[model samples]
Target chain A: MPQIFRRSANSYARLSLLGALLLAGGLIGLIMAIGSSSYVTRANEFIEQPIQFSHLHHVGDDGIDCRYCHTSVESSPFAGIPPTKTCMNCHSQIWATAPFLEPVRSSFRDDRPLRWIRVHDLPDFVYFNHSIHVKKGMGCETCHGRIDEMPLVLQQNSLQMQWCLECHRAPEQFVRPRSEVFTMGYRPAVPQSVLGPQLVKEYGIQSLTSCSTCHR
Target chain B: MRPNQNSQFRNSQLPRGLGRWSFGRWECAAILLCVLAAGCRQDMHDAPRYDPLEASPFFRDGRSARSLVTNTVARGGLREDDHLYQGKVDGQLTDTFPMPVTAELLARGRERFNVFCAPCHGRTGQGNGMVVQRGFRAPPSYHEQRLRNAPAGYFFDVMTNGFGAMSDYAAQVPVADRWAISAYIRALQLSQRATVDDVPVDRRPELDQAPEVRLPPGRPETPPAPEAR
Candidate 1:
């Protein structure tokens, strides 16, 4: 009777071990399906913009002032998108016939504002004041990642807080002023004439490595 | 040095345990997420406090503060000729008069005008004042048809309530002083339109003398074409 009981106990132990192995294997397969080797589709996968404004055009051709398009940058916290009226002031005579410009023309006719979809998004906790940056000489290009070259206005940088603070901590390594900020390659402009050092002198921006600075 | 058999098993066990952790990655992650979820506790009842005294003048009515100063200066002014809209309250603590526009009060008015109005409206009451030199577009000339034709009471309204871009002087300039400024502005309009017949015979001589700008004439090298361009 004892020998028979031991044989039965051993069989039961084997079945339990096999059950455990199967559960573990199933869990591993689930993890691999959801988490293992995560992939990111390239920014090229998406294309949904109203006007399809070529950043390459204005920033390259007309030499229009950045402030002319983004007038509120020096005054408001936002680097404000220009109003429809602002576009109509010039486009009423220039590109009055373009199909993409219909939305802009409609807004002007309706006396309504344009609801532009923001291409880049940042967490709300980050308090970024464009006025101080613009006033102190931070350029459009330093953080925007060669925007003048993009056809459909894809976000060049991740714009994650860490990415911002990395430059904010060591601005001399990354930041450049108006003309230089928009450049595609490493801008070898003079140091004091550039934005990174001038902002330090003008406003004395403290180290951004601290969480309190951006988080607040 | 070669380890004993028991010690070798122990060493192998250590490696195997570490391997087990990596092999069972979902278990490790699930435990980590559970721990993180347990740690997150928030209390959301704390509210920030603010003091009313620290509120800006725009929020707190600043007119009351200016009225305090106005009451003290209101005693000596043109006691008549001002049809001020006073329902019952007479410039915060005084009841004797709403605004006194006496000759003595007009002198104070002239003094206050030079202090405030002359910067925007010239000493001669033309809108081409010193502020216009500082790149501010001058207001239309006070003697212009529109402003000249405007009522005396309407001029007082502008000083008290302020026209566009100009901040209301109701807080800075006293109400009686505002009346004084209106009287002086009217005096200017009358001066421009006053004829010899309009002026009393005794005061006609001075009123007839046309004012002239004294400029150092540059004797131009060749000066025959005298038709004013």
Candidate 2:
């Protein structure tokens, strides 16, 4: 019984306590990693739509302005999805008889909306206004990424609160001139450090971090 | 038993199975943590209310957004101003602009024309836009004598009501923007036919200098062919 608790048992007990602490810390780190990862945030995921509409072809090749299709981006909280009539505007003549455009034609003829899946869906609790962002000199490419380059659009950023907070805390780091707000592949004529703060001041963009700013 | 011995007596009276099943402080904390972790449900993330364009099971069309009832006019949607809304006065398409034309209005017209009209009508009003190159019906050149003589309200009417092969842009371009575009079209008509005498003496010298070669906004340089992702 005297040797049941050996001197080496003290070292074993110390190591067990240290291992327990490490395990708890590691578990938290793993949770945080998973929470921010694309798997959880749905970033970079290509959603399947009723039609494989190509932003690359329209925006990149044809140089159609974003307002051409998303007509309400400047005026509405939700960027308006073009109706089937919008698609038929050009498709009626360009690809009038192509089999690929049958869905668009049918949708127009049948007066049924083509169910285009939303790519940048925010959580229901979070309120995002596209008009405000566009008005405040936030370039579409800043949040949507190089949409002109994406044949099938994917969400560019993590739609997590922390990801949003990055811009919300310091909007000066991301704002552009109002003229350049719609320009894709926008390069600041001056260094962003100089331009960003200037535009932020000019636009009077507030670093609103209150819970009501987004959550309400 | 004495007060000090009471606790010991009660512990001794507890069942052997109960004693073996008792949790340590760390084990109780771990169990609480697991319960809290499971509480991170997505209930708040996806609330019951519909987001814009969200599909709905209740509707026959599966749309959360309902279409406006036929002939339903919104408040202040009556649009009684015939000159502003219809581009007409006394049921005739007139030449006069409803609003006074200003340099600012022309600038807005230039921007709006580039966005909405330039796809079919070329940026220079040459009727050789990218869409025309892609096999869409070529619209008549704005520089043509017939179009140059056309009234401003006629252009507005064509935009409000479909003209020949071109569909009406009433849905895409707002009423104010249509007039602005009409003004821009007039400017474009004048540009192609402008003589040196048209420029003021002071500004005429600047015209001799090579025009700045910058591409308009949204007009990217020749893009590479679409690569499969």
Locate the minimum summed-lDDT window of 10 residues in model 2 chain A: A1-10
Candidate 2 C-alpha lDDT tens digits along A71-131: 9999999889998888888988998999988999999998788888888888888899999
* DockQ of predicted model 2: 0.57
The 0-to-1 C-alpha lDDT of every candidate, in the order given, reads 0.59, 0.88
DockQ computed for model 1 against the true two-chain complex using alpha carbons: 0.03
Show the lowest summed lDDT stretch of 10 residues, model 1 chain B: B45-54
TM-score for all models, in order of appearance: 0.40, 0.89
Give the TM-score (vs. native) of candidate 2.
0.89
* lDDT for position A205 in model 2: 95
Error of 2 at A40 (Å): 1.0
